[model samples]
Target: MMGQLYSVGRNIEAKVMKFVSKALIVSLMGASLLAGAAHAATTDKKIALSNNYAGNSWRQAMLKSFESVGKKAVADKVVAKVDVFTTADRAVPTQAAQIQNLILQRYNAIVLNASSPSALNGAVRQACSAGIIVVSFDSIVTEPCAWRITVDYNAMGRQQVAELARLQPKGGNLLEIRGLAGTSTDAKIHGGITEGLKNYPQFKVVRSVTGDWDQTTAQKNISAVLPSLPPIVGVVSQGGDGYGAAQAFAAARKPRPTIMLGNRQDELAWWQQQKQDGYRTWSASISPGISSFAFWVAQQILDGKPVPKDITIPYLAFTQENFEAELKAIPKGGVASKDYTQAGAIAIITKK
Candidate 1:
């Protein structure tokens, strides 16, 4: 009777072990499937890039970066479709209409470079209501429902003033070269510069010119106004205007001021040449590849990943020490940029 009891106990233990091993295998398989679902969630999604403007070199570079990334993701079956639409004019209404069209087309996601911060809120709201993801970069929208990849334009402006103070202790008259007049980027930077000037009262902005963020436009505007303005000790510009500002000063036959640069290849090359003549200044710009970053952010959202509504992208700055090396890395006729990979975008989103 004791031997019978012992045999029964051994049989029970073996059956329990077998059950536990099967349960463990099933649990592992379920976990693997969950992981796969996270990555494959967006494979059937269609994404669109709703660009408001592409008139400048930076804009062109941005489009190219998005194209490269978008094409690869489509080919790899990461997303079902990727399409681009740029308004011929940088008008809020045009973009609004475009957004409406995109909604009608039933795009799963829309990556945006908005024409205005607040003007497009209605369209953006409509998109959100339809269950589409909206991610804006560069010139971003102000709508609460949209995700923004923003730059600290205010901080950038303030830093420019601080850097100028260091470069020129005895501050004099300054010429402020602005970007596209109606953009949030323009407004924020101008506001920051105005605010920053409160601390550095010795520096006075004597005149302001709209460059439209283009070389020829900047040169034309600066040249037309240079004769009327006071002697500028420094020219603070909103990128893409630096090299053109230099040209305007040269044309006017005036003494060259310490002009702050944007990270265009031509601007960097011009700065490199001037460094030989004892000229000194710094360069900074938003990476054009931010379009690609925005693309991935949109994709990740479709993957059901949690992301912040407001995400700030770092502005790339080049000092006198680093400009030469950076210049070598940038392609001619393009702005400084670095494209994003899937892993890279995930890392950025995770960190944020």
Candidate 2:
């Protein structure tokens, strides 16, 4: 009777142990599934890059940087996919239609270089209403709901002219090589240039021409107008035309003025060459890799990170002392001193 009782107790104990073991295994499986789901949520985001124009090398470089960073994000499984679309006509309506299509396609986020600041407000609002993230950089949007990633163009323009004034205290005729007319950046920069130049009365803007932020266009325009203008002692340029301006000076067999360099690699190379010939100048620009910064911002937002609506990335300036190092870091035909990582982008956020 004692042996039977002991055997019954042992059988009951074994059954309890088996039951507990099964319960533990089921609990672990549930935990694993939860973890997997969390990871999938983190990685399964779709990002789209909406470019307003690809008219210049800077824009081209910006798009390339975006693509490179997007590929890296995909490889790291941080984002599932990246889609790129550009409006060839560079019209606000065209870009608005593109954004509408992106909304219809259900992109998780859009990284945009807007054609106009206020023109895309409605389209951006629509995207936001649909629970999509929108982050604009470079040529940005005026939508209050969407995030903006950019440098202070006003400051940039002011600084460029300031630098030119420093180089030429008794500033002579300054040919202002402007970017695309009517764009917010161009207007801001132009305003800054005008404001900053007020302190230097000797400096005169002998001519102003729209380069459209294209080296070839700038070259053609400068070439056409070079014969008509007085000898320019300095140039206030909104980038993309410094090299072309230099080329025009060279072609005209005229002495190169105290030209402010844009952060273009070719410009840096030219600067280095000119430096060898006892010429000295400095350069500053809003990096073309700003698109990549915008990309990272979009990623952070999609990952549920709280990013500020307005993030100002400061302009990068390279002087004679560090131009060589800066030039070496960039790829052939790329911007100088650009940072493209998530941390790099995050480091520049002025608010929140």
Candidate 3:
């Protein structure tokens, strides 16, 4: 009886040891999985924004929008950091050197507002060869491998000219305010304006000036030229200078001609004030929030998602009927009626 009892105790001890071993193995596996998940959640991604110029209010607003979006990305662990670089002189060589620096830093992606369409092509290709994603918006690059985000600037130009033609059916002298001198966007818009005016032979562009897309510059230049030119019947202008042009004509005490407006809060406010005097006009612009859109695209690519090489965003147009409401919705000094969102930017990607 004593021997049997001893044997039973030994058997119980063996069973207890086996159960504890299995539990220890299970606990170790669970701890390993938890560690792997934590590592994945903390993985870091770095992005850079390369802007060729930030000389005007429009560009300032654009940079702010990008920073806003990038801040949220960092908080959510979507990106570890976002670095911004700008060239005030708008030189192509300077911009190319910036791209090389970004590559050396091993940035996962770059969002570029190119200085020239073709000048940045080689630098863009070099970055791509080094396995970095390049996304361009606003003033874009022409490199085939880099993704592009843009509105149809040519169409915007044509639409403005068509509106001018409508206001002056009999045809008259047009004061044309062009953007920066050598940008691809400037050339495209000028081409469209030329084509649009072909149908209206009676209308002629008497004087053309470069506003450089700034309010003060537009006012100064237009004010100086008004004293020398003939009676202007209409005005066709690019963004950022419509309000200044109106102010110039107001200061001169000349009859305000039919002017096509751009998307600026001050311009819209001026229109509101003029509405009391029975003044009316149409406004359109390429949304300055496009930098935020490009930032979103870079985030998507970093996450290993598929996206289109060419993404085109449309310009926002506001008529007399809705300009007041649109203006009311935006914040003080805001460029657009709507703010950009990650989902909205993602929707721009074209599915294969």
lDDT of 3 by residue, 204-255 (tens): 9999988877788888899989988898888888888898899999999888
Candidate-wise lDDT, in order: 0.85, 0.81, 0.79
Number of the predicted model whose TM-score against the real structure is largest: 1
Measured over all alpha carbons after superposition, the RMSD of each candidate to the real structure, in angstroms, is 9.9, 11.7, 13.2
Write candidate 2's Cα lDDT for 14-60 as tens digits: 34454345445545677433322222334778999999878666777
Report the C-alpha displacement of residue 87, candidate 3, in angstroms: 4.1
The total number of steric clashes, by the backbone 3 Å criterion, in model 3 comes to: 0
lDDT of 2 at 288: 81
Q: lDDT score of model 2? A: 0.81
Clashing pairs in 3: none
Error of 3 at 33 (Å): 18
Find the candidate with the highest lDDT and give its number: 1
Off by over 4 Å in 2: 1-41, 329-334, 350-352
- Poorly placed runs, candidate 3 (over 4 Å): 1-43, 165-171, 199-202, 329-334
* Model 3 CA lDDT for position 301: 72
Roughly what TM-score does model 3 have, to 2 decimal places?
A: 0.79
lDDT by residue (tens digit), candidate 1, 118-169: 8999999999999999999987888998999988788888888988998988
